[model samples]
Target: MAEHGGRDARMRDAEARVVGTVEFVLDVRVEGMVHAQAVRSPYPHAVIRAVRTDDALKVPGVLHVLTGAELEADPSVDPYFGSPRPDQPVVAIGKARYAGDPVAIVIAETTAAAAEAVPLVDVEYSELPYVVDALDAARPGAPVLHEAWPDNNCGSWRLRHGDCDRAMAEADRVYSGTYHSPSASHVPMEPMVCLAQWHGDRLDVQTSAQAPHAVREALERMFGLAEGAVRVRTLNLGGAYGAKTQVKIEPMVACAARAVGRPVRMELARDEMFQTTAKHAATVQLSTGVRHDGTIVARRVSVAYNAGAYALSSPGASGQGLTRANGPYTIPNVSIDCVATYTNTVPTCPFRGAMTSQLAFAYESQLDEIAADLGMDPLALRRKNLLRDGDVYPTGEQMHDLHYDAVLDDLEHAIGWDRPPEAAPPGKARGKGLAIMLKNTLTPSRSQARLRLRADGRVDVHSSSVEMGQGASATVLQLAADHLGISADRLVRGFPDTDVTPYDTTTSSSRTTYAMGLALQRAATDLKAHLRTLAARHWHVDPQDVTVGGGSVARRQEPGADMAWEELLSAADLAELVGEGTFAADFGLLLMDDPHDVHGPVTVHWHQGGAAAEVEVDLETGRIEVLRMHANCYAGRVVSPHRVRQQNQGCAVFGLGPTLFEELLYQDGTVSNPNLSDYMIPSILDVPEVITSSALESDDPRAELHGVGEMALPAVSPAVANAVFAATGIRLTELPLGPESVLRALDERRRNDDQEGTTR
Candidate 1:
């Protein structure tokens, strides 16, 4: 296993090097392809009074300019895409709901020409009142982004397990607080790009996406094409995080391609990427009932998610938030009400941790608040309520292979939780804090793979799982090689091509390595059986007597009967052997009819993780520097220890930006800091001095393998916030604890302290 693991790293690095040399989708050249640029709306909400494309079409290289009116008139173009409801239009039709909303596409012979023509296209708009805040949008008589929804509420989800009012009435103490998380951008190095071409009845698209199959389905539905007529191809992505999980700009490019009778390429600029989709900024109100002995009796949480102009995946995100509001602890009674509100801002989608991170920031911070109120150690309270094996979740799902206690112990030791730290400078304060998280692995989805054995004894594995720098392709290669009894070097990783590779669900929810890996294993197993049957027929022996090992087949009882795989295939007169396998979750067993109902499992598997952080705060500048961070999570079996550690550490560092200095600042309805110059992400210099992580192996057979991609992210932010509270006894309930906010909090703390001293 160790040797195979090493080979996986080498193969992954080789693939990375090859991908690094090539440009992304924007640079994928196709003959007779034209460049397309979108003319976006400048107003957050406005009436599209007129659109004149005469000047744009008169440009020397301009081929065509397509407007939303044309799309709305065409019966073939659906023009809208979203989950639960198709609300987001491909282009602004009669009205533009948000700034940067695409209203027209200008296609020209060259990219420069297309860009130049974009400004020449005239679009008249009448501005309308707009609200960007989620809470403000939810108010009665607020400006509704969608006319179909009068309340401006996109969707609402609730989970009711027990009687929260009664439980709180009987508890010894109750603590309540409101926590806020800001909207942030994914900012993948390679922004959203798509290249689409139409050939007769078929439509082909090459895009930077996490889910090619989903994109193919969306395109087929929008273009009114046959199921197999639309093909989606994906290359190595610079990064996806979670932004690329859904359809972005493929529909626009496809429309432009068909209009111009040639291929069309569109790549979003950095500012456009920022305004297209972002993380849902959420406001959570949490009330916890606890006993004097540090036992949580009941919990009630109300969350409002900023769905921003359209309900893309906000319903699902809101459901996930409601389900995970209880965190990783054991509570008798829990009530959660989560709602996604429509606001005139960029539509919200999943980020690294989805809405789970936002909820963790609330519940974990509330846990610390409760601990302080009870005068009990925060870690001790967590240890007391840690869920054990067989414990039931608030949703009535049975917990399995939960190693929260063990993970906490490892995290505490790694962060020196019990050890007294060296004294800090007179003006600096140092403290340690911990936070735990639980996430559900998406389920009830289908994943299929095709394994083909070449004539030269090599193997090729094909699937639609996008290699978005998550080490998914490398893991699949290792699993296939091991299962086929061949060296990992002999296997070739196949690119994701919808026409060739079997269908796979999107590569999000950390399910690629677990779900797709299972499919690949089954396919390889079937191929091996086929090889054994072929060898047995040649040797005139029973199939059971044929043994396949080390890329060779032999008769078990006969001497000198070993034959190389290639020789056997040649003798059988076969060019290659192919095997297909699929893994489908039983929705009957996995999904609950009403996720809001308290019973039944809502997810296929649970992801458990925790983090510990040590922070030093400067009293003068209000700057908080993380001295070190330690994270731990259960990764049933380590595919590549190096990759696993890298993912954990990367997520930890990513969490730093959201916790300290990342936010999409909004004024009226425009994003003030749309570019990286103003919107901050953590750089190498921002990383801590000592970063440590550990992946624990689970003993339960049910947890043979699990995902580690997003395990550590949700926990890191709350851990840092808790550390800040520990250092200064000031509780910050909002995200991106910037220097200004920190200073304001400090001043408030000092004022309150001075008042107390005078009164005494």
Candidate 2:
């Protein structure tokens, strides 16, 4: 109920008010529709000795039973991005890789029947040795999850630049530490449900996926059908937060429908949701060398990722290991080697900021130490090494129009940063810390927008960018309304349909507000331009003489002569006009096509953000509560101030979770905290009160609009962790410095001091 950012005062948080869009879902009386369910492995590693389906078939209303070997109805599904990474089969083929691996599926007349038939289908298992920890999995003689790869490892991303040894030798101080980053779940309010039906050559699949086209492509390949034969339509998503970015039950549902020759729907219970999909844990080793002036002279970092069972989301695009390798500041000499190995855990998927959040913890935390050691202001240290425009990354990606120092400078003023106390609050330890970061919406990751002038003279917009409760569609609608010279409500929003909608890169990287908005601007302008021709013909004047505004065309100098939108359309003998567009970050200088190699260097784009956090560390309990948050993002433009604030709140809350309380516990080959009860997420009350988020923007040619989604999250945890260390002189590298962890750090400090006093 509290006021959001400065937008239309009449609207709260610039939230697009949809009056009649909601259709009360009515229970349908269908002639023939069936329900289905799945049977999963209760063991981590096992072999499919035999599957007996006779007992399941005998259950009343139980239609049929299916196993991985019998799942021949659908061909193999392709992995995301069409890489050589192993594709998850519609069902397990030979052996069960991890706990919750789907070995078989079933169809029945009723939900009750399907539930009853699950246990009746018997599956014999031969247990096998499993490696759960990624680091342990890489050791010699460790159990290999995949026999083909001798030492279990999934993927590697390595980047080396400058003189590493020379820089280390010149450094006055060198600091090294190990940080443990844990996995968390997406926990979309609506668990996950997919309904798939195929009739001859045509397929209709309804799902709650953040990435619809990705799901469609995977489904198309799975059934071995022509691209046109498969159609994926997304419905109102409860929430995504990057977890739904990957396809989950769509393939299984489609496979079941094909096997049963009828529509099949699959939905996971809340408990199964915990294990089947969640964030993957990562272990990172970070080291840095600094000069007496607080300049980062040398850096070396390595990452070991727990790419659960299979390599679903283990490419390590922007993760903890990579974060250690490089981030916002300039480290002239750097060497980074990151390895993502295979383990018998659920394949880790992208959640919110993905790997960036974990990396910020290490990089930013270390930065604070470097600044303190040199007796320098933390903000000044960041400003000194902050990357300016045209900086090149070790990955050979040149940063365009970067403004890291400006971002930090802006936050210092916005938050009134005068270095709040870092020691305990009187009897308590309260501290303040700030961190800076950047990210990109990324290109070839296309987002589409369609604009059509409706019969009433208002533009109708269509896109596949799922709302994900991020207010994306609302932001697009505002942009269209502003462009078309009409009221915001006049823009007609189209329903979600893959067959009709253009390809969307899926909303992440803080792209929707900028990259997608740019494309929408183009599409709307095109529509208005074409309409000018219609108006010119009606007025018997040159098209250039016509002026566009308020959904009408008028003579440039003639105020009263402006033609109304409806009149122009009527004169043109059409009820509506149409236009379409798509845009991604331009990578002209970043990439070059090579005939020999599949791809070439695509330099990174620029995004700069700064944030300051205030924390109250209770000594009695070690409960660290964030009291205030402030940030400034030079993301080119604030498309909608209200929308950007929500984006900021989301990133802050997500960043705070792992900083204070969230951990994935593992014992032997099994996950200990696969459920939310054990892995704590921030509640409403857990969110801070002083949280303030805002952005800075200026026009630049390098990127149409600077991307800002994940950038703010990377620095948050490290800022908090560094603040805790600044107060207590206790540097805890592990994540989720929960109450117990904090107590342990303080206790160790006490023990060390006592021993020194006794020895003296």
The estimated TM-scores of all candidates read 0.97, 0.90
Q: Would you give me the overall lDDT of model 1?
A: 0.86
Tens-place lDDT digits, model 1, residues 1-760: 1112223356556654675674457568988888899999989999999999999888899999999999889887788877667898888999999998999999999988888899999999999999999999999978878888989888777777778899999999999999999999998998999999988989999999888988899888887888889999988888988889878888889999999899889988999899889999999999999888989989999999999988877866687777788989899899989899999899988899888999999999989988888888889999999889898888877787778887888888898888855678998888888898998876578899988888998878888888877778888888787778788878877679999998997899888878888898889888889989999899898999999878899888986779988899899999999878898888522255664553677676788888899999898898999999987777877778888888899889999999999999888789899999999999998899999898887654345677888899999989999998888888889998877877899999999999999999
The best candidate by TM-score is 1
The count of residue-pair clashes in candidate 2 stands at 8
| 493-585: candidate 2 lDDT, tens digit per residue | 764678888778676656676667767887878887887888888878899999888877889868788777877778778877887777765
Which sections of candidate 2 miss by over 4 Å?
1-6, 9-31, 72-86, 316-324, 410-427, 536-542, 555-560, 584-604, 699-704
Task: Assess candidate 2 and give its TM-score to the true structure.
Answer: 0.90
